[model samples]
Target: MLLQLDCLSTCLTSSGSVLFPITAGGGSLDCFSACQTMGYGQILHRHGNEEDRVHLNVGGVRHQVDPDMLLRFPHTRLGRLLLCQSEAAILELCDDYSPAEREYYFDRNPRVFLCVLNFYHTGCVHMMEELCVFSFSQEIEYWGIQELHLGPCCGNWYHERKDYIEDGDWDIRSDDQQHPSLDSSFEELSALDKDLAKFKGAWCGDLRSYIWLRLEDPGHSTASKIIAVASLSVVLTSIVAMCVHSMPEFQRVDDNEKPIEDPVLTVLEEICIACFSVEFIIRLIVAPSRRKFLGNPLNIIDVASILPFYATLALETADEEAAEENEDIENVGKVVQVLRLMRVLRILKLARHSIGLRALGATVRHSYHEVGLLLLFLSVGISIFSALIYSAEREVEHTDLGTIPSGWWWATITMTTVGFGDTCPVTPAGKIVATLCIICGLLVVALPITIIFNKFSKYYQRNKAMEGQFAESIDFMSSVIISTRTNRYQTDSQDVKDVFFSRSSCS
Candidate 1:
């Protein structure tokens, strides 16, 4: 049970050391904790009233329950109302700091002391147990020297010489081949050529000079080359693709029209195919694994476009009829031609790379249930509209109401309210039925969309409220921790000053 104010007392006794003064620490710093020295078994057996003292032996110290402590620290009182809620708040505060800070704090005090502090201030002993369980490995031990572990101002003191500790003289270069040559044999060079060559060969002899050269122009060699090549390739490919896709052949050919044997078109296709093949080859060669290349969607697209053209030549040598049949196959050689359409996907790719898009994607992914509800509602509309169209359009015989599948085509068009007139209800009753179906379709389609949007709005509002609550909690915790630490520092400083005066007097 949460300790309510039934009694109040303060003991002024000198201890081993003062972490904080009993008063004047400012802003609720004088607050004390209620403790129970008796075990749960004893409390259960005695069944004492709320006013009765329960002397609990926590660690080696016997602490008497002071009901007034709960009144002083209201957070503790509320925390005792729900252990898990208090536990969550403590965990959130702990997350703001690192595991190293918790470890350092736990190491400085006894387990029971931390437990008391947690239960009294945060009202959670489980959090204290959690902090105690984390192991301090060598790397964590090293990281423990940072601001999270020590004073924020003492940052450089701990981190300044860490590299030396890990490995002294570790960075010394052992191979001369790794360095470039300084002396250029080509003496008759222009000013720009001379400057470029000098820069390239600057990292030649001394290790310190090489480090300085790299620091000044990091990624000097490979990065510049990659940027130049990528930019050139993108611009050139886009221009070429625009010209190719815009060609007269991109238009639909009549079914009865004979195939055109245009040498110019074939030559252009061959060029594009060769370029795509070379791109695929380079990707395969440069990639760490062939499996990685095969897995890439664009790489597969490139391969599909180019590889079949090479196969046609082999087919031509084996059997002329097979080659002729391959050439006759509609859209067989149009794979490279389709690449122009893919340029529009670049915008989507850019969005995927952006932080805003990532946030949007996460939001959408989290709201999948709402999205699914909207989709299901749309699907129902489609199904009902399709069934209606099939029933209504079945009598329109000469108007190409061919079958149920064909009726569905008309249904899709009608439900979207597209009213294409490519297929329509011919009879008077069918037309009346179509009009009523259209009206109903619009309402049915909107229902799920409205529901989904409403749910999403509620979800967004709830998240915003939670975010505000979290921010306030964080600010409150920060004030408490800073006040506690500052008080501790001041008390320690004063003790040191008293000790120094005493020593001088003795001397």
Candidate 2:
């Protein structure tokens, strides 16, 4: 008999029925306990009685609904609770239901619940005229319904609500206000504030945000573009000045004689330096964290490039004084020349503003493993070929490849196909080794180039796609704002006309 009762309980539970044990005396004991344990026992009892439909009380409105209809959206929170097969709590008074009748209570807006009920019946929801998109979306979310379940009209409104939320335009306090005109204007201003906030750093009152946007962000703002163009021009001009300074005409003749610096180049250098120095100083002063700013490799490069100019000037001054004192100053002048040459490295600063150059840098960084493998293969090939050539050419008189180290130079040139002709393997065996090195070089060099090129293409394509999406989103938002303003203007004009007609009729 016990085994039979256990089998009966399992069969009833499997068939979506509430499990309550029956006694031989025909009296139900622990019914409340069984209902509480089942969680949806009340729903199952109300649904089982086919003679009477269940009634739902939602926000003071009575909705007489077929119990089977509630189970239509079984995947949702409400449906799952009322299906009797799930563990979700349907009500706090689960044990208070009478055997003859039951009424479920819910404290949700009837209007939103109506839409939800319609969704369960027809697989679609329609936002009513009296309901705003944001409020309706909130109800939909609470009901565990996805936004995509809405129709086209509601779907568009849902997307707009999402945009507004992402832009931080919603105001909790304004929800109680009834003035649509004022609220719309306030939301527009809030959206503008959100856009402007992107130019700012996380912390308030930090000027580093503005500096960073102008320097790093590739925004379409006029100020940002102007800064980028000016920075690029400065970098190019500095590079040109360095190149001109390196020409033979600019070289000094003797320790006593001074170098004839071009006045035009000198003026350009000073201007570029002044611009860079001011920018660097402003960045340092406005930086939120001094240590982080100093630690950045690009910032360090900027400082390194700028310091060389001052060092060159100081060294030139010392060299002049030493020449006047008839002291040895040739080495000091050479040091000054080296310092001036180092300033040419400032050309790298242009990469910060150029997307193409930045993409190339990123490609190289991401392809490090492929590049390392190619380099490793090349190193092994160079070593093997160098050893072979050293053995082959060691017997020849007056040969550049007489030692292993000297043979390495020949191997490198041969593999690169540079054929500098300063060193060559004269023996037949050495020639064969040199040929093999050249073939290996050609194969190894192609591998890294292929990897880097693929990376560059992928990054460039992703950037273009992101730019397109950003532009499309901006255009869509602009159209929404323009339509909103047009509607407001029409409403105001109608209100003015009504006021004039009412006064004329009274007069």
Candidate 3:
């Protein structure tokens, strides 16, 4: 006679409780009844007075739970798997039991199940100190728990494990006993590393890889290049439009004058604004982190440049309305003109997509110290020349340099060789000082320019070399793949030939 060791009965009591029996040969049914009374194998029925109750047998341990509570975390696999209404495969076991009193068994870690159960109940998951992060992560995945749903403790553990994996702590191996050659292994490793980097970057929400490929990478796709080119054209057109708008001929006749609109310029301005606004908004939205996006100086410039266009429109409308209402109302056209000048800053956005501009920006950054020193020297020269001219021209009557402030302006213009002729020294001492200032200006301007140019050239060459190396790496990877495929084909052909000979000999 066969002995039944563990059997779950489909019987339901009058009180709506399931009975499960753990029996051996000729064992008393009293033991099973005793276990049920001790709450070892009881399944609470849905129609019972205990409406939200459920009884689970996990790792041979009885757990009383609330189905309503577990259903709160519908995203979790366990939550769905345990619920009667869930369509998960794990719930199919319920069909073996009576619908009035369902009893299900799961060979799972009771301790871990308790932790998961609590998480569903409390929205908090604590990582057990004894359990390794890797093991816990596996269990979480098995349970269909989302990483985002992890509490702070488990979340940190997950990130630590993620970082370890990304840092190449894991080993890569082939299933075949005959290992690949050194060159092939190296190529495989390189490809794996690249793929791993992309995966990690995406997981961390770092948009750098995506942005670089679309906007900055030298080997840009056709669509990306088209976008870049179109954006460049719009930016250039905007600059030209602003220039034309600033001309004297484009100014209104007076504060009250109704401005004549140029259809072409208006349409062009709108198009440029629309393009820039769309680009800015798209980048901002797709950025991995808003803080990181706003932190970039170039991104800040992009937003600033686009804002003035809308401001100008608003100001123009207000100015037109104010002009008609009151002659005393100040014309905001001048202020709008000043704000429109800021649109010129959009030209800097080219640096994001253009190699030459990027190199130039790098050059400037690298030469910051050198530029600072040059400015220091220029400041000293300006101060000395201003003092001398002020002292000399102060004694002279009817001179623009009669005051120290005026003298400073004269010094600036004279030293830069920008003689507007509006202010000039009238005395012998002042003339000598002005001559010295002009000579100093030439040296000061040329020194910084020469230093910047040298730095720019160096960085430009470095960038070119890096691009060349990148292209070579891509070609080498392609060649490796082709060779590997060829070798695989040859090995398969040899295996087929040997098999054919063996069959013929057997025949």
Identify the candidate with maximal lDDT: 2
- With a 3 Å backbone cut-off (N, CA, C), the pairs that clash in candidate 1 are 36-56, 37-55, 37-56, 37-57, 38-55, 38-56
| TM-score quality measure for candidate 1 | 0.36
Per-residue accuracy of model 1 over 68-108 as CA lDDT, tens digit each? 34333334322231122222443332222122211111122
TM-score for all models, in order of appearance: 0.36, 0.50, 0.46
How many Å off is the CA of 374 in candidate 1?
6.5
Ranking by TM-score: 2, 3, 1
Error of 1 at 457 (Å): 17
Enumerate clash totals for all models, in the order shown: 6, 0, 0
Model 2 C-alpha lDDT per residue in residues 220-304, reported as the tens digit of each score: 3577678878877888988988888778876555465755677777888999999999888877765656675687667887898
C-alpha displacement of 196 in model 3, angstroms?
8.8
Give a tens-digit lDDT track for model 3, residues 307-343: 8889988988887687698755465777886886787
The segments of candidate 3 whose C-alpha lies over 4 angstroms from its true place after superposition are 1-212, 248-256, 284-291, 313-338, 353-356, 442-450, 466-507
RMSD of 1: 23.4
In model 1, the runs with Cα more than 4 Å from the true position are 1-46, 49-261, 288-294, 321-379, 390-404, 426-507
